[model samples]
Target: MRARLRAPRGLVPSLPAFAWLCAFFLVPAGMVAVFSLGESAYFGTSPVDLSAPSLDRYGEAASETFRIVFVNTLQIAVVGTVLCVLLAVPMAYLITTRLTGFWKYAAIAAVVIPYWMPFLLRTYSWRILLGDHGPLAEGLGVTGGFGIVDTLSGAQLGVVYNYLPLAVLPIAVALDRLDPALRQAGRDLGASSWRVFWQVTLPAARPGIVGAALLVFIPLMGDYVTPAVLGGVQASVVGSLVSSSFLESQDWALGAAAAVLLILLVLAVLAAAALALALGRLVLRAVRPLDLAARLRPRTGTARPARVSGDAWGLLLRGYGVLMVLFLWAPILTILVYSFNDGRTLPVWGGASTRWYAAIPDNAVLMQSIGVSLRVAALSTLVAIVVGTLAGTALARAGRPIRWSLLGLLLVVFVTPEIVTSIGLLLMYVAAGPALSDGTLRLVIAHAVISTAIVAFVVQARLSSLDPRLSDAAADLGATPAGAFRRVILPLAAPAVLAAAVLASTASLDDVVASSMLGNVGTTTLPVYIYSTLRNGMRGDAAAASVLMMLGTALAVVVLAWVMQRRGQGKSFAAGLVGR
Candidate 1:
């Protein structure tokens, strides 16, 4: 206790995250819920009083247009998710159990580096690469085999391409924690290797797989970017439906209604998750003989004792890894190499130019947007760490009821779409009037609330993995709550906190739909800037800007990883892998 007191007062380490949630996350989301019930405004900061809380908006949810987009969103999300699972399982397997040393590091890096490229740029890159305007047609020796980029299929491919990493990471973590001995026992019991994987490893990793699936699918359901540019109207998803309601038709109420439906759908997904978890527990208890989860714990503390060597499947795995990496990064790479492109098309490799990169300075509006994004991400990261750490610690130490509520609230925020978040923030701002309606503060607050919940989820996941005895040991040694936390919990949980902060920052940085809707005139962020550039057909400069954001993410993450390591947090990086 005395040591903690002496450490630093700045690290009070006891911010009331619940209060933070009420003020930011809950209030804003509640405000949006109200708006979803009421009518939307015309141009100013007021909800239209044309109607007072009605089912009219929700009625719109049942419309045929709604049905089509909803079905489309589901179809795309399901297909994309399936592809992501197939691609990621092998990729994760290779990274965790097969690859060794530099190859391991390289594989991990490869999986992650594509994110440094601006998402818009990556989307655009796929456009050019797969388009008849690009090289895929010529290179693949197929006249129209490459035309897939212009259809709904292209959008699905892009969504899967972009979100593959998100899906892979969680699955890999689950795979990392699997007991190799369980599989060995299966082999000894005369089970085939494939049977062992299906009956043993797959079931063990289901929660993570389910979580990852939901994580990918929900946002992708509300995803605006890929479908907007790639699919046009041919394969438009619900995201496009929601977006067009606002920008194209200027129908905020309709958009808010759609956003509300999306939010409900997300909640339903969480409920389904809970039901599954409960059923699994019940199934576990039903028969001690049916305790499948119990049997899958890994005996090997270490993953992949050796690096993967050669064979067709190994090559196939490596090729898939490369293909996925290329699929994601080739756009950024094309842009990087082609931002120097004197011509819009590539592969001929002739006149190189940095004209676009040089022109970035001239794009004052775009540059300002970048500044806005950085500031938003930085503020969100700060708020997220404080709230996430506190909430996480509280969940670990608090009552079960409180823990479940906190988790439920966090899940609600996590599953909610950005458009819904934006609408919610707008309603809050409208209700609050000029106090919050017309400043960068509102955008920051909106981002912080949602991002913080995500960070808290990460923090809670990490904290739950801790041995409770560690905190108990500190307390038994006469450490006060704060002191014990500082000495024991904080150091151990620091890496998770840092990771949460980074992810929050990335969410903030990458967010365009929310920032654009909530931001004021001339309020710009990197994503908004990239979006504007893409909208303007400034593909080259857009690529340059995208590369910058991607580079920034890479630099920030690398530096964060390095700093965390310096604090002896290297091993604890694995702390939050298991959702327990």
Candidate 2:
């Protein structure tokens, strides 16, 4: 008889996450694809009618209106991503190189705090700051203020501010991990600081830079909140268009088609970028020898290169860092100050009072929404942690083929626009009929789909740095695989697990896209509530609720930072947040 073949040790452990993604992610996405080829139902309970499938939906998606919005969305994403890279590189450099100990952690906290705060709250804060009669306009002494409130420029600014930290964290982690000796060696070779940075540091940090760009660009492409809140209808993008198609127009076929188009657009942009990069590399390679020859040519005079003063460079970077921190904190601080407004409207401040803050407990809907958000975030975080930890550990021990395959799937989850995910989940839940009728459950499941990928990346980053032999040693000591994981690997991964849990919870709390799509009347999350209120002219009480949410988010960031620090894995922990 042939010997029985056994599965790989890591394969079984990772099956839960794999299965979860297939059920919740792939199936829903497939359903969306199928729905895109169908027509809208005018009479049936279902939004989409699959009886007759055609590519007509795609044709409609390619109409003049969609083409304009698609172009605008791509422009915003490209420009915002470039700006994020420009700002994040120096900010990250300052945090990793200039700051030390307390200040270093303080700087990180500055970025993470605003990042962890509710996404709607942050964008809404900008509505107050850049509004007519706002502080900035008043300070500038403009007649009718800046008039940026309902413009593309306002949306662009908000997108950059909201996603800047996503860019910063990954770059900081990359710079922090760089070997100091490389810089020292460059100095020993008489290379100027500028030359050393350009030649060595920048190249070494390329992966982080690329990661940061994608981190900002992917989400920016699908962001509807910023454009909706700041730009209003005037600055509509593909994301808002898709959303309106589904929620307002009840045109499921058009929405599904738009979502598919958005994904395709993103992939096309990435491909174009890759091709451009490849062509640039070829051009650079062809010219490199000539450039090298020019450099190696004998000098006729004894003149040396003019060196920039290190003090000047340091002072400039420090100033830039200060400005960047102010940029990150400005909107949040604006929210806190406006939360004390005694007036009814959020933007207009009548007087400083704690009335809004005090009235939070009295708002029945707000209180209930907070409760729903907490419950959903808590339950989703729990599910993500369990599934993610297993998948993460498995990836650390799995074969290269298995690891790459899983990683690729997670990357898809990361890069696929959130609006696409939201629409897919919405379609999937609708298709499930009454079986998944519970709105809160739908919210939890959708949030968990995104969070699971985040946690897995964090845990995998932690485990990758550990000794694989530890598990082997446990096995050699007569321990079962389960016992070894419980006794050994679990303890070692506890910090990352906890850090990831906090991060995932904050993500779920801050989510606007998925929550808005998946949530209903009785199951609304706090972010969704705030979003609705903002749409109908935000009130003082809403600002108060935002302040409270920010405080909670800050506490969570503190805990996450402390946990990562305790294990001396602060750098990787930060990078893992963006799945680097």
Candidate 3:
């Protein structure tokens, strides 16, 4: 009787969103998959001609030039992911162990605030910093072949700096969730501090570490802006290669083939991870007998006093924490300082001035793009809030089949590289011709497609943590289902929903790859505008726009942090985005 009463609710509220995704997101993605098999067709042709498809495009993508790009993508992504993980693990440990109260939040803020700046601006700042006369090269006396700019090393550095939050937040979540009792148990068993960490804490944190690696690696493979501006023509990665094929070479078939290949590569990585997890489970099962026997046996060693070296190790970790914070923010701080430079060239201090800030309103193209981005972000966030909140609420009470299906859809959206999705959507839009090719509409749809999954994740986390009994109690009273949702669930989940909206708005504004591929003459977002400005040597103007965008982003993030803190979730919302 009790089990029957406890059955899940909210399934009915979810169907509208499920249908919306099927039409916009799923159908568009299916079109991409179908397009992958065919030759590039002339515009206004039938959408999918199943009559004759060929493998020639795939063969073309495997050519010698592309082979090198593929290798570089793998090398750079792996190295970048490794570097981010190694750097983040220690800093996460420091935050979880050493810091407390207000200082704890401050340390996390230091790490996350750099992300408030658009990614393109952040990567371009690296371009300024690595120039011949810049602080880094001049201070270190680097020159000739030893220079970082225009090299793969520079691209790798940019990737690590940009993606570090992906690693830190997840690992911080894992460490935050550690069972204190288990740590005490290890010490009570006479294990040293190092042994306790190795056996208890590190093992518990492995999931977050693996998640962090996947999050960093998947996007880094398709990174365009970093390699484009920082690595220049010399350093070719998969994203640059694919961009050239479509935008520069106009070989749609070859670009689609390459994108399809990249998607497969990401899928293969996920498959390997799944296989490894299964093998781990098997090994754990095989070792359970020995573990049980050992536990049953008595221990003879006396518990020693807690190790005195913990403070020393903590101090060392705290130093690394400070260094990591600086590494993440140095380029951004440089950009902020350079925005005020009166000189035409970057990194040269010509008396302090707000001339660039004053010039922003005069750049009509830049101002137009800002207007487009604001509208897109506003529309995207509104759509995401409605659809994602419904889906999130539905998933909370959904039975196993529905839950797994929605979860799989979310994973598909999450792990698919942005470039692959961008190209796919581009192909889909082109096939539909003039009637459906409205750039503003396409940009909004693309932003919503990407933003919905993230918003759903944030809302889902909050919904899962809600007390079902309150809604039930309201139902027992005079409240209708709609009324109960409004009075109980809605009020409880409002902060997370607000936070999700803020995040969605920021993501839409900051997007570059999709904006680059899908934006037409009428629709260029801030990131796309900044990319072009940098390419054309408009440093001061680009800096002006970036400063304005960062100010807006900073406002959004402050709201996000405040709401998340009010919910007592801390930075868990940031972790959830990647962990999902």
TM-scores of the candidates in the order shown: 0.85, 0.94, 0.90
What are the per-model C-alpha RMSD values against the true structure?
Answer: 6.1, 2.5, 3.9
What are the Cα lDDT values of the candidates? 0.71, 0.85, 0.77
Off by over 4 Å in 1: 1-15, 39-45, 50-52, 141-145, 268-319, 344-350, 476-478, 574-580
In the range 1-580, model 3's lDDT, one tens digit per residue, is 5554543556566776778677766776776667667776545455334468878778888888689888878788888998999988888888876899877878877886786578877787787677766667767887632467778888888898899988997888788888777777766666677766765688778888988898798888788778777777666877876787778876666777788788787778678878988899789777754452253333567554567597788888888988888888888888888888888765565768888888888989888999999999999889888888877877776777777778777777878788877777787687678866888989988888888877787778887877778877998998987898888887777767776887788889889988998999989887888788776654687687777778867876667666777878645554443332
Clashes of each: 7, 0, 0
Clashing pairs in 2: none
Off-target runs (Cα >4 Å) in candidate 3 are 1-9, 42-51, 141-146, 284-308, 347-349, 559-580
Worst 10 residues of 1 by lDDT: 5-14
Q: Identify the superior model by TM-score, candidate 2 or candidate 3.
A: 2
* Tens-place lDDT digits, model 1, residues 1-580: 5553253221233246667767766777766556567676666645454456787877886687579787777788778887887778878877776688778767776776675456676777776677654666667776654667557887888888788877877887787788888777875665445556777777777766876787687778778787766776777766666666766776667777787787777677667868988998798667645554444433455462342334754677777777777766667777677667776533233478877778788888778877888887788778777877888886666666666767676776777777777776776676677688654787688788877766676777787777988988998999987798889988878778877776678778877787777788767777776676554455566566666677767887777767767877744553432222
| Model 2 spans > 4 angstroms off | 1-5, 282-303, 559-580
The C-alpha local distance difference test score for the whole of candidate 1 amounts to 0.71
Name the top TM-score candidate.
2
> Whose TM-score is higher: candidate 1's or candidate 2's?
2
2 or 3: which has the higher lDDT? Answer: 2
Arrange candidates, best lDDT first. Answer: 2, 3, 1
